[model samples]
Target: MKFLGNKSVASFLQVILTILLCSIIVGMLLQLLFSFWVKNSSNLNFPLQLNNSGLGEFARITTPFPVSYGFYIFFWTLVYTFQVMTAFIIFFAIRVFTFFKNNDPFSYKVVSSIKWIGVITIVMSSLQFLSEVVINIYFNHLDKLENGPIAYVRFNPGLSGIFFGLIILAIAQVFLEATKIKEEQSLTI
Candidate 1:
């Protein structure tokens, strides 16, 4: 079936984003439960395995598994931040698409929503990076290193989302200008 127009695509996206948002909510809940379980579990020590096996070879093993409190806190913090910010971004995206489906694609509210999405994207990416730093710090602490040369910054830096957000900001700027031109044309008649 062919999509009628922009509305069709927007409506479709709205549905998808709604599903994703719901999933995020459920995921956050599950993670919380899991963290609680881990924290309260009696078996504080489990098998710790690290395998760097070659082709058709066996594996290796490491020390026992001991989940530190700092690690637990860091994990939960990262999960909560990433999940909530992601949900925020998707929620705003849904609003933007809803505007298109409602036949007001270039309305002020729509443009504003896009701008918000862009800002939120940038913020979320930064938070993701920060999360990595938190985990790295936790590891360094666990290793008993005062100032060891260690870093946990991911190489990619999650730029794709930031780039996409910047593009959306550009689109919002274009819409703002086009909206002005349309108003001027209407006034001439």
Candidate 2:
């Protein structure tokens, strides 16, 4: 049950991450193509949920409206950007696993990858929060039926994701200090 080295858990995880990375890329591309196809078809009416009034009311309320092409593209762009960032996080995680498998726990690459993961996670979380706000406002204006505040914007900016990102950053700092100590010890010996 070793943490590092060949044929260990790290190596197995690296392989799994590699596969996951490929799958995400492929799936995203396919989704983009399908989205375009769906857009071109005239028969399909895109359903827009006006509000989350209540559990029973929400399920029954749905309005089919023609969303502008520009808005549709913009929304998908935000979704795709988030997905790409997610893929990058996974890619960096794979790099960390690769280092571990090679028994290089204190390598600069490992520390850098971990730091990037934290930074990306924080950015991704914030971007998602902002995008949600923008989409809500846009939809509210689009919904002709609702006269006042059709979409209520929640003040709750997803703090949990940001907190998790900060924790990861702290872990990266610890890894950095460990790397420095390891280097100093090697020099002394």
Candidate 3:
């Protein structure tokens, strides 16, 4: 039997989607390997890019725990964990868009995919906040005791991501209700 598919997107869109998916996967792999190599073989500092000038803005190249080893492991694990989650989010989006390209916009699968994306977005933001706190704490501990503790913070105004996730979540709900209505209408005839 022939399967239903989205026809709104042109054939070239599918090709582009495939290219994006492949590149994302490759990039993640390269990052993973690079992280390992740098952490184990070199003192490459992993710059914790933050919107702050002091404390927690930077972590030691591989791990942040220079004095304590546990913090290093914890920080690196957190970094990789979020990296994997981000990769999943990107992959999920590509797949959902592919469904749209095939014209399956109202399908339950697409709605679910969107919901998952929103969930991950919130999760990623939370993880980043936690990471900021951890890095700052580490740096604060390292601050010279005689100099008085440097009061610094890396607060991520995570508004844009949260807003975007909320919007996506709302869109998913709308699409789900629309799908239900369409199904009901079909059954009545």
Candidate 4:
């Protein structure tokens, strides 16, 4: 509601935020579906006995198409979610910076909050990526036999770079806001 004070900026932020939230929700759902598929796959025998080449080949061949599809969906969802969230944070930092330029009294608090949120989001995203990498490595190692068309997809480094850049921008916004607040305090005195 507070954001609605500035009609244009508020509307823009609302639209972007809505898209980011929806993407995140979809990503989570896709991940859940993938997890279920992995859990229920009978071909992926427990202990993952890599010694038996025939069984390994059979395992790779027998992996359900749906499971692979689910993984693909989850991967893309994650990528989009991260990109959208990063964009949202950058948009917010820009808005806060604009407020600072206008000498708004609340700019400091807003920018600080945005920075903290960006930091938290970045940390959560990093953890999610790490978890995905570990899972991929485990599955790849278990699936030793190259039976069918092996789909090897790499995580987008550009997305990570964007996230890092957003974090830095957020930090800069916070510093700028703090300076604005200091200037305001001096003016008031």
Candidates in order have lDDT scores of: 0.71, 0.82, 0.69, 0.57
Over 1-189, each residue of candidate 2 has an lDDT whose tens digit, in order, gives 998999899999999999999999998999887988766663423333444654433222334455688887887898799889989999999999999999998978899999999999999889878887887777667655545323443455777889899999999999999999999999999
lDDT of 2 at 26: 97
Model 1 lDDT tens row, 1-189: 323345497789899999999999998888787777766763432222233543444333333346577667776787798788889889988998887777766667777887887888888777766776765556557546533223232344677777887888898898888778777887899
Worst 10 residues of 2 by lDDT: 55-64
Across 110-160, the per-residue lDDT of candidate 3 in tens digits comes to: 888889999899887877777787777776766554233334555675777
Residue 144 displacement (Å), model 2 = 5.0
Candidate with the greatest TM-score versus the true structure:
2
C-alpha positional error of residue 141 in candidate 3 after TM-score superposition, expressed in Å: 1.6
TM-score of 1: 0.73
Comparison by lDDT, 2 against 3, better one: 2
lDDT of 3: 0.69
Worst 10 residues of 4 by lDDT: 42-51
Which candidate's lDDT is highest? 2
- Of candidates 3 and 1, the better by lDDT: 1
